[model samples]
Target chain A: MPKILIVDDDPNIRQYLAALFEDHGYLTVVARDVAEALQTAQDERPDLITLDLDLPGEWGPRFYRALSQEPELKSTPIIVISAMPGSRYAIGNAVASFTKPFDREELLKTVGETLDL
Target chain B: MAKTVLLLEADSSHADALKIYLGRKQAEVHVAATDEKARGLLASRDFDILLGNPYGFGEACPGEVKRHKLANPLLQVIIFCPRALMDQAMDDFGPLAANYLDLPLNSKALGLALDHAEKCIATEKKLAAYSQRLSDLHDAQSLYQQLFNEVPCYITVQNKDLRITDTNAKFKRDFGHEVGGFCYEIYKHRSSPCPECPVAKTFYDGGSHGTEEVVTSKAGKQYNVITQTAPIKDENGQITQVMEMSTNITQIRQLQDHLSSLGLMLGSMSHGIKGMLTALDGSIYQLETGLQKEDRTRMAAACEQIKEMTERIKKMVLDILYYAKSRELQYALTDVRELAETVVSMISPQARHKGINLVTELEKDLGIIEMDPNWMQAALINFLDNAVDACLFDPKEKEHRVVFRVSPRDPETVCFVIEDNGTGMDRQTRETLFTLFFSSKGSQGTGLGLFIANHVVQQHGGSITIRSELGEGSRFEVCLPRVKTDHARLNAVPQPHQNVAF
Candidate 1:
């Protein structure tokens, strides 16, 4: 099973995504902010990352730049998830983008392709 | 035109001869044989020339001629007497009489005398018309001077050098500067002319120009003014000076600042709303799955999150509504204890969730207080909510506590005190907490909480005192007058108006 990292500031979003990924036979790890997101991404080395654009302190793109600078995690696919409508183009190299309350089936299809499953 | 002559001669033959001589010169002569008859003729009619012999009236003729000349300065008088009385006539009449002549008049002499008198009449008529015009010019000048002094706006006439040459009464009253003062120095207290001067623009283009400016008065008060400049031209149509008139618009700009900030506040608030809505969706998703799997833990947690999110949304909506409308307090007699209790209840659950102890001490009977109940409760809630947030943000390992105390300070005052044993403000934050535009989201979490809270307290005729120690705790005491404010009395009926942001 491929592992996924959930990065969001909201606890409820983290809980819901964790439960959904686990039930779908995928391993899941969660981080509350940019600092935690970077630490967990390095420690767990998840197969994929679902990134939220807005956070309490640093934005998600800043975390993406930091992650890409790491030689080992440079190629890890990133899926952009955000409530901001115009955030799709914020990270030019994003694998895919999904707005909040995105359709579960479509998100799953995009996630499946990104992981090559 | 023909000149009219009054002839006074005792010799009828000589008078007839004079009439024939005067007629050839286009003069209509009226003959009066006696002095009384001549006086009657002079009183009854207007004559351009008076030709008479002074000896016939016995010294009365010269005096009468002088009196008539004084009454009508434009009338010409000619005295005809024998060479014996010519000197006396000349002395008595002097410049009053136009010409003097000999009696037993030679045809050439009489003809020459009439011609001289007629010439004097024409010159006097021309002088009279010129003098009438001169008086009319004086009246017009005074009328324009009155208009220049009475206009309401601050008007100044500036020359090419931007020096104030003249000012209206209003300008002198407000600026109180001398006429030769520099326009910049008088209006703006600046050493040099302003970069975007409307007066200068008018001088350059010879067309009216308008601009808005913030100027300082002589009393050091600032005024927002809309200035308009028009070129003051000379008789040859050359622009000599520019007349600048400024109307004070401080009140209008102040109102606009309030409204403009309101517009800006709404745009920033939408981001917070979006985040909350996304969390709401997450909660709904959990609720749906909890019902599907029959998981008691998921259902309970989902319900709690939903309740908290909804409560926050409801509060934010109320805050928006409060700020959106015009700031007219709807005063009512409210139970003071109830109002305090309601605020505490709303805040206690948050304190509990954050692992902070919440305590309340209220007088048994706080009595009924006159205030806007809704605004009063919102203000108290903000203070208490800040206390809980302070406790949550504290890095100390020691226990945290928040105490809300309500009591009557006097017969006319009720007080509310919120104290927290949590992170306290530094020296800078303490000094500038109540200062307007004191926004730095460090000590006060929304940055607007304390600002709006202070405003609410002041609106209710109240004061707020803050005490805090860094790394220890903070306390806020709000003392409000128990009776309605004078603002409420004057605004018994609120006038509806467009509201703006500050």
Candidate 2:
């Protein structure tokens, strides 16, 4: 099964994605913060990663920098979810973007389209 | 003029004798025996006094006396009743009992009662006049009280000694108990009286006075108090009291100050930023020119310079955004010193690259200030980053240095100072430092640094001022109001990257 890494500071968000992806026949791994997400991305080698912009530990710019600088995560087709005013989060690198309170079906479709699965 | 009396008697012989007696006494007498004859005599003539007999009467003597009185309550009633009938007459007609005499009346006793009635009438007129005057005075007093209480501002009556003698409901609500206290002590929280108090001037000169004074409450919150005093005059034109009204203007004054400073800063920043943009446009032209001349080396260098200059301008634009977003934008208590330190560290890399020594002197024992932490940090960063840039090392210089100092001005105010020992500003530049787009650094600086810095300092109920001279360096001072409220713990933590600067 294709694996998806869902990284968010909020526990509810992590749990909801985990349940949704598992029900949709994809293996899911959840990380609570940027540091944990980086570790999980390396250890699990997920097919795709969904990151929240406003994380508890490190915020928008720092999280985006962490992804671009990391060798393993650089080409992982990362998507950023933010409730921030703008739809895009640009730091040092390019990444797929989605505004927060996004629908589950849309999230899955974006993931499917990007991964071609 | 002749004295007249009318006698109505049933016996004709007695009527003739009574008429003769009255006529011999130099009084005109009219006598009528029958009721019909009496009515005919009354219809043709007016009589001042009526004398009636007890015997041969249709109604009783008491009833006869009452009928005469009913015709005129002011009329004098003299009853000619038998001595035995006097008590019965008094019992039946007490209100009409002006005087009673036995048949063959004693005129001396009648003369005394008439004198007493005349005195009573004069006393009644005087009493009526005095009662009307009292009612008028009552109406005036009620109107004065209504006006005093209904006024919008806090109003009070103060005696010559400056003691509040009376106060309205608004006065009581604002100054706690308004009456029975010194005006200065209650309103200004001052133990000693104010120097040259306007209210005192009114009391002494019997003239009105008004002034705006800064006052502090018991809790030490400051206020701009506007007081108006009008002398309350007595009938002799002497000032017996003073009426005072006060309104608090602390917030309004602060807001006005903020607006003026923001206006100045925005004006200067806009001018400086535009000037920098112009320079950037010039440099880009030069780069294009160099390329057209087939000078690859010069074009490459110009492009590098342009890129660096553009990056600096971009940073300035970000500073302006951060400054505008958080300057007095309202938030909970945040650790201002920690935020200052964060900015210091954030700019440390740049400081290191420029070979400038960067230092922070943040006081650990500092009160938390109510601020948006992200915005406050951004504001501090603008100052620090600008200072580091200005303190860049000259070719022959041993070491360039920039310093950041955060000190407590009591527990309620924190002072942050950013000083640099680079090529400092001249008088003209310092004067126009905060003017919009008025940068001295040409294309290199957007001139928004100090402008945004002033705005940030002002937002926290603090002030920002710059002191600089050509080549000596510049120092920017920021004063931030301290918070004594309960959100102190949350403010002390250093949260990273939530920095307000773009």
Which has the greatest DockQ?
1
Candidate 1 total steric clashes: 5
Score every model by TM-score: 0.68, 0.48
| Candidate 1 local lDDT, residue B133 | 93
DockQ of each: 0.37, 0.01
Model 2, C-alpha of A33: deviation from truth (Å): 51
The window of 10 residues in a row where model 1 chain B has the poorest summed lDDT is: B437-446
Relative to the unseen true structure, what is the C-alpha lDDT of residue B264 in candidate 2, on a scale of 0 to 100?
67
> Candidate 2's residue-wise lDDT over B1-502, tens digit each?
1456667788889788777766765667888788766767766666656666644566644465467568755455566577887787777667665566676566666455544444444564567688889999889888878877777777878887788899987666656763688888887877878898888898778777889987654444456878888888889988888888877776567555545655665655553454344345435645665667777875775665566557667776676665443332557677666677678778887677557888878777766777767667767787787777666522236578899898887777788889988767777777877765555443235556666666555545567778987778889888777753333332222232233333
lDDT of 1 at A52: 88
Q: Score each candidate by Cα lDDT.
A: 0.80, 0.67
Q: Write the residue-wise lDDT of candidate 2 on A47-110 in tens digits.
A: 8888766554256566657767778677777777654435463543435676545555777788
At residue B4, give the lDDT of candidate 1: 87
Question: Candidate 1: which stretches are off by over 4 Å?
Answer: A1-3, A11-29, A101-116, B1-12, B16-47, B53-73, B78-152, B158-210, B215-223, B230-242, B248-267, B329-346, B356-502
